[model samples]
Target: MSLEQDVATARQALEALDRACASVTKHVGETVDARRLRGDLSRVRDDLDLMAGQQSYSAYEPFAGVYGDGDDEGFGGAGRTGR
Candidate 1:
C-alpha cells in the first residue's frame, strides 16, 4: 500500500489499542505496566503527528489533476473551461 494508507492504518490501530488500554485499566486498576503502555502509546502518536506535519503532498497524488479533463483542447484536453 501507499505511505498515506500505511500511516492511516497505523493511526487506526493505535486508536483501537488506546481504547482497549482504557478498558483494561477499568478492570485491572492503574498498574505500573499499564502506565508504561499508555506512555508508549502517547509517544507513538506524537511521532505519527510529526510525520504527518512533515508529509510531502507531492508524494501522494503524483499526477492527480496534472492532465485535467479531456474536454478542452489544451494539453491533455484540459482546455480552459473553468479559466
Candidate 2:
C-alpha cells in the first residue's frame, strides 16, 4: 500500500478508536484509566498528524539554506533576509 493509503487507514482507525474511547468514558465516568487512554489517543493523533503533514508539508523538513544564505528569514541571518 502507498503512504497516503496507509495514512488514511490509520486515520480511520484513530477515528474509530476515538469513538470507542468516548463510549468507554461515558460508561466509566472518566476515571484515571480513561483519562490516560484519552491522553494516549491524543498523542497518537498528534503523531499521525505530524507524519501525514510531513508528507505534503515542509514543517518538519530542514531549511534549504542551512548555512544561512540570507534565506534563513532572520532566523540566523541577523534579519538580513530582506523579507
43 Cα displacement, candidate 2 (Å) = 0.6
lDDT of 1 by residue, 1-83 (tens): 88778889999999999998899988878899888988889778777766767644334565558745526465555334554
lDDT of prediction 2: 0.76
What value does the lDDT take at residue 1 in candidate 1?
A: 88
RMSD of candidate 1 to true structure, Å: 13.5
TM-scores of the models, in the given order?
A: 0.54, 0.58
Q: Write the per-residue lDDT of candidate 2 for residues 1-83, one digit (tens) a residue.
A: 98779989998999998998898799889589998998888778777778776542323446555754645444555545544
- Misplaced by over 4 Å in model 1 are 53-83
Screening candidate 1 with a backbone cut-off below 3 angstroms (N, C-alpha, C), the clashing residue pairs are none
Candidate 2: worst 10 consecutive residues by lDDT? 55-64
- List ranges where model 2 is wrong by over 4 Å: 55-83
